[model samples]
Target: MLRLHRSALYYVRPLLRAALELTPSKSDTPVTFVPTVAGLLVRAQNENVAIEFTVEGAGSGAPISVPYGSLAKVEGRQHEPLELAATLEGNVFRWSEVGIPQVLSAPALEPAAWPSLPAQDCANDAELLTALREAAATTDIASLRYSLGCIRFRGDGGQLAATDGRQAILLSGFRFPWSGDVLARRCPVFTKLRLAATDERHVGRTEDWLVFRAPRWTLWLKIKHEARFPDVESQIPAREQADTTLSLAEADATFILQKLKHLPGGADQNEPITIDLNGSVAVRAKNDSSSVTELVLSSSERSGAQVRCCSDRRYLQRAVQLGFREILFRGTAAPLFCRDTRRAYVWALLSAEHCLKHNEQATRIASPRAATAVQWANSESNSGS
Candidate 1:
């Protein structure tokens, strides 16, 4: 019997639970145990690495190896033949084992020719690289779709927009010079690009990978999720409404949002917050509990610009916290717009209901100075609602 440490036991429980949930109980699949499995071999491939494992018992036919990279964080003895206990979880095989040591083995990469990914020339590689990383972080993992002929590269580099219907993000500051109609192809390599320029310029290419480098660090990503992104070209509001240039101070936006964040159950979902631009800039928040709080945007130029729409306060807060010099809220229908003039690089759509809720809350919190700070604090305390 192998003695398990408290820490090790603690770590194994969740993994065992997950494996038990993922293993197939009804299927007859022979399990093949591979000894000397290299732990880090999966991490070192210049391109996406695929490994096949054969199961020894049960006869689900020959063992099929799926993408082992999708394993939820593997940990155990790396130098021992760690026995993987497989059980049935729904239609898949969940693996869990105890006290098995295995050495890491490098996967055999075949000498196969891979197509070249288009290379774009960027003046400042650092900025473009950073934007790619930030955009990648916002991607959804479960519903990711891949396309080989969907990669688009054009002269003058362009923006990359990705969304999964519920939420979307637009990243800009990409300037790459490539000739032709912006060829679109599937990226065949595992590419990593580090950003090192202040203006966001960087580029890199591996055997089958091309990296977009940035100023501070590099991003290693697999080129997946390349489907026809929705037609957002017509989503942007045309310049029609009387464009009001509102000067927003960073400190002021931060302070007001902080106050509005306190409303109970108000900011949850797409609850609209009201913005009263009459004499001074004001923001209001409310919840189902009938709790309301209002915050005033401390601005010097109060020309009275009023607009209301539904939005997720959390999204608005994140955009403001990113330090945009001026924020623009335009239009009232389907494809509402919110642009950060400071970065002038990213924009997002507003949620209609959230905008309306905030607007009403703002109206309620507007006049009373004595209750403003108190309400703000209480609202924050009960914000999870």
Candidate 2:
């Protein structure tokens, strides 16, 4: 019999669910519970990644494997703090809540038959998770450019880079122990698991796998070939190449973001929003039926030039979200560039033809100036009512 706090189980539930996500729906997933001196060790894996964590408590019995499908049906309240005892008898595994009469049972599998997992001895101190996540966000998962689906960690200066062809992010100053470059697929599990501050994070590499390890849990991602990835350093434009620069104030950024919240197609990050700089900064978003156009900041607020560019709304939003106050634009055909202290982002601006086509569509709707005022007035009126 094994007794453990429900809090411990709840703490590891996200990892379990993330493991489930790694496999296809039709597959019958088994979560192995190995009897360890510390407590119970839960392990799950798929083709792309594997995850396991030790839940420390009381345990004394043979290791048992339980199907996640059956376990999910009776996992009980997740947020409630309680104690539970589990026991494996013959082919069935059962767990009952302490102080409660309710007991749940699930079919069991032979623990010895479970596939062996890779050993983790992660001592690398590169702190690559944060950089990996930021670079991974720029990868193109659905594109045929397979190389763009992976993040490259350069051993030279510990630079992490990824691009979706449309956008790219580069993070420098990471210190990796590996002397050669490593290309790793941007797996969601790496970013999904939350690491506690108390837990010492480390990265490990074997012949075939790259491992991310913490105190109680570890995850491994398959390494990819770096031969296909493009030379990221050469792709970034030189500082002098920028022909126009817009330094937005905090208030200007906030107003633009607020207006975006009310715009159509908030769900589609790829939706185009044109930023026009003439005497004022005008932001516009339009769909088939409705359109939103507003002058977020006047030229008096900041110096302006006659330049216009269409960009992915999410790309722009991400720059603002990352506390980037200044963005550089070379021309409509050039990529937009922004950077913080350690990271730089390059967003490919939509072509002039694309912007023109969208503008023609917007012509069917009310003029930007009038439409924005009307929408703002209507919203205010509705709120007052």
Candidate 3:
């Protein structure tokens, strides 16, 4: 029987769901479990994404290689196959389900030696993890580019950047101070890393993998093969171009989008909504059968150019759910930069093409903290959100 922590599984659960999204065949998807001196490795790779979830030891001595199906749960030898035994508080989970063939027939990866990486103690572990989580939240898992499916972190000195094609997020001035660079020695280069954050004793990396070592918890992740991250910096619109700025409440933004989804003809993918900021904040949409006009709460910068920013209802709505207190909407066509309002560290952009770029500007939010919501990607990586 194999044993591991429930908390560790919390970190891994999202990766499993993502891998499942990669493959259409859900019935017999394979999951391989392998053990190493560091911890237990839960690995799955499909055409879209290849993810490895690692959990530090629970003092169970050595771990063995085992295979399982997506639906199978850990069970004891005497328990019925219908029952499951797993906990999240670091309790041990017993895996002994005996009925599923795929669970019994999965392949085991050849045991490879782990690489030695530079170990450093970081102070802002939780904040860093939160940043990565924010980035991962904005990533498009369904992207055709295999690299786009995973979260990318390109940091130099203290700056980090991540993007999902349509939108880009940049973060600078992190709190951690290291003798050597975290992901790599070079700066401004992209490194596809697993989303993980914690104040473990030693956090280090090898050429191919990042290893997190805690007394009772551990994570191992394989970095993406591509060395180059997309060039998002060149695409960001300059601050001066924003003809309109708004201080829309995060809750209000969420409420408006949620209500639009309920509108009879407002939620379809093909249906586009015009967020007219020329006057009172409003959402305008129409379909073959009907149309919707809803008032949104937001303060305008000016009545200058009538801004008619058009975007997919769902995409815009999803952007609002990112939980930023306020967002700065530059103008139509140009990307609307979203941020914490209280801090400059976290920021996100609505997809540039889908949202369009360069537009007639008019409208302003009341006293918006000027900044972008930077994308913080999958932390507790190896177990990412």
Candidate 4:
């Protein structure tokens, strides 16, 4: 028999929703009620992610396999305690409120069928969330290549990175305590696991699974240790190694992003925008349909170099959105680089005439030779910690 407050179920409802989101609706055993020394654990799993959380219930019996929808339908207006009493005929669980004739019942799952829980370790939530958001920004959400689509957690340098073929983002300052380099899918589940800075979060691993425990819940996802992630550090230009640097104030960058966002296309397939950094910063975008509408914005900052380059509007907007105000150009052919205190981003540059000719199917600006662009020590001074 087990007993706990009905409000406990309400508290972990968000966690349950996150778990169910990762799995199909019709899975045989979407949720399992397990009896542990700490409390009654509600757990669920799929191929990519698993979720578990504890409620203050007391009982010992075979685990129950109830549909999440069935549990979600239970109703109680006033605060009431819930009880699950073990019975002989197939282990049925029943709960009822005081002075209420209605009762809710669910069938229990056999103990032999439930998967075992693994051991755990402490994890820093603040650092983990920050790394996930930064690295996941550039990951190809729909790519078939795991290396390009998933975020790589490397233990050696305590770094996290992700890349699509066209652009990449990397962040330092993470001290992952894993055995080696591990790859995790950029699932929206991590974004939903919101917690306070003081909450206790934990991580654990088995041979095939990586488990994460929140203050009220636990999650297990498959671990990819053998995957080969690209070397993002080598591709990014050092602060002193960029040729032409263009610095934009936050207001200027935000203005450009806001203007270019509504132009024509979505994030992946957007129109090309030309950026001219001669004596000042000038941005121009045009629509060459039946009505050729042109848009231009200029900044008063005169510290820019005399270089003009074309870039995907979405990529530029993403770079600015990640708080990268300094744009570094390695000649006109090499990739564009930008960095802040802990994050470094690099994206391919597009040719102005080629994009104009090809329309929506623009190609990368070809580089004639890999020549080291001019380096400026002053560019490093703009970076903030």
Candidate 5:
């Protein structure tokens, strides 16, 4: 059995909610809650990470038992009746679920093989979570095209990135706070995984898993390597090659996104929007009824610099959502680069057709940047040492 303070359960409870939904591929799996002397031991597949918490209280010495599959549905406290709840009341714990299997006793206990403590490679938790959340905001959920479903973390370059084949976000210097049975995680992990920023944190990697540890808790994530992450740096057109460097018009961009996001057409019927960069910016697209709608951006950096590209209208809105203060426009066919002034976070999106064609050609070239985003995150790993 395991014992934990009431507040502690409130904190880690959300994590149990984030475990991946079971699939035929089993790439996503739920956490296995095993009682341990340390506290509670939770494990995913070998490729995934587990979390352990230390419990202290008068009842800390007593054994605690949780059902094997109960981790996914834990809601530890509530004033009203709950179909299932593991509530904590003034150091006392009570649980009842309408339909779950009765867990009468703590399962067989065994020593768990834990990762080394005080991880060697580390980044501040708050900083890392900020970067990771930004990148994750743009990941694709409906399709499994390429590595679109996973966030790639580069430990060596200090980069984190995500793409849906149409648009991509790349951020540097983040420490990537990690998690879960993720009925959620695809986008929630970005904003969720609420570890305090004040705590000193470090993250390390074993053969195929990433370990993130804070003073109070630890999180591990599996390295997804079944598919290759495209070489993002090289795919982005070199700045020197851009014909027009423009500042993103936040107000105008937002107006355009709100209009097109609800356009009547289904995904299959969506049409590419064209951004005509001249003396100013003119964004043109169709509304739900296929009627042409145009918006102009007047504060462009350079006037009359002609360049044009047709891309997914929703992606343009997403670029604005990324909230880049400055943007760069290359040739009509190149992907658009929207980034912060500090160059800390970047988002790149090419038209669906162009994005696919670019990947085909990009595959023919070699990247000196790195093999994968996060299989190895340090310079030493690049040397194969």
Candidate 6:
């Protein structure tokens, strides 16, 4: 019997989950049982190098020989003793003792016949490939699992959609090649497109590698969740009273974030920070503790345009760091809309309550009639948050 240390077991669990998620689950024949193992092995390709034993597994009958390239790369002594083991029972493969059980659930068998796709016929692959890379980065290897059937391509351009519940991004422009039956199959496949004779766009077959064409550029990615992405177009605000665009230098934005960093009770629901934008040219943020940070925007028109809202400072900080040229504060009560004019990116909404709690004087700002308005604003912001 092999006994793995608690730390070693923890390390191997996520690795096994990631590997298993990438493997094809549909069995042509009945699979008895497959228990995970952990052990180190010397690379046959590069015998001089050794790899740590993160995860390994075997079927019920014979020992499984995995390719050296198939293993996820980790830093450590390559020649160390690698733990390995496996068991088989019917078609289901379960991890009997891989150290971390919570990291992975038994992967369900893939359907025999997956939903069909049209065909693949595309010229440019830049957009699809880029979107894939961005999406893959948003998810961890252990959390991503999805099957790609044949993709039919048509038109001069195509679009890729990615989402993680909190945020969604859509990139458009590419060509798709259309093929009927060819697009129907459950397997990981990469689609490479020649953006230019010299430039290539590579979309990963799964999340493991970023398949793109560029000289001297190599990228790898982990698989991402394949759940249906959200409908982003529907979330855009329908109307805007004032489209105030301000291009603050990155340094200025950083300064604003720093000043607003410390608010009441940090990010709790009770200790809200108030953002007063209605003043002449200064944006004022104050907490219950009388700590006030005022940022003066470079604007000549002060106009009594002040609106008060509350938010989690951390969330706001992240939004600012995402590099939007102008922060579009739409309607005081809803999530503040931030967009980068240089790129088509929209951030997740921040809640009004989270912002409101920062200001101990939020109730004073709302009247009986205005209470309904405030509630509507908060509800909208909460939905986006």
Instruction: Please tell me which predicted candidate would have the highest TM-score against the true structure.
Output: 2
Q: How well is each residue in 1-385 modelled by candidate 1, as lDDT tens digits?
A: 0111223222332322322222345122221222222211111112332212111122222222222222232344332222222223211323244644332222222233323433553455344544544444334445545332233333343555544344445555555444322322322221232222344544434333444433322323333323444444355444344243345664465455565576555555665565545566666666776655666665423332456555556655655665544545454434333454212322354554455334332334332244364565466568843
lDDT of 5: 0.50
Misplaced by over 4 Å in model 6 are: 1-157, 162-167, 173-199, 204-229, 238-243, 257-265, 269-275, 280-290, 294-306, 339-385
Better of 2 and 5 by TM-score: 2
lDDT values for all models: 0.40, 0.64, 0.45, 0.64, 0.50, 0.36
RMSD of each: 10.6, 5.8, 10.7, 8.9, 13.8, 14.2
TM per candidate: 0.51, 0.77, 0.59, 0.75, 0.64, 0.43
Tens digits of per-residue lDDT for model 2, 242-338:
7777877665565455556556655555777777765556666666666554444532132435677778788888888767777887777778888
Model 3 per-residue lDDT at 176: 34
- Name model 2 segments beyond 4 Å from true: 19-27, 78-91, 97-105, 110-128, 264-270, 288-292, 298-305, 354-385
**Local error of candidate 5 at 201, Å?**
3.4
Report the alpha-carbon TM-score of model 4 versus the true structure. Answer: 0.75
- Candidates in descending lDDT order: 2, 4, 5, 3, 1, 6
Candidate 5 TM-score, C-alpha based: 0.64
| Clashes found in each candidate (C-alpha, N, C closer than 3 A) | 77, 0, 34, 0, 15, 62
Error of 2 at 56 (Å): 2.8
Candidate 4 per-residue lDDT over residues 265-384, each given as its tens digit? 333344676666664466545554422222333332434346777788778888888777788888767788988777789998887562322223432222111121112112323442
Clash count in backbone of candidate 6:
62
lDDT for model 4 comes to 0.64
Better of 1 and 3 by TM-score: 3
Rank ordering of all candidates by TM-score, starting from the highest:
2, 4, 5, 3, 1, 6
Specify the poorest-scoring 10-residue window by lDDT in model 1: 36-45
> Mind giving the per-residue lDDT tens digits that candidate 5 earns over 1-385?
2333334445555554454333445423333344454544444333344555443323223233343343333444533222212234211124455545333222233334555543355566466666657666767766655667677776555566676666677776654333321111243533656566587767666655666666655666665646566666666665566677766544444445445554323253445565666554565554344544455554334533566666666666656666655557766666777655323323443463422111111112111222332342344356743
- Which scores greater on lDDT, model 1 or model 3? 3
* TM-score, predicted candidate 2 vs. hidden true structure: 0.77
Q: What is the lDDT of candidate 2?
A: 0.64
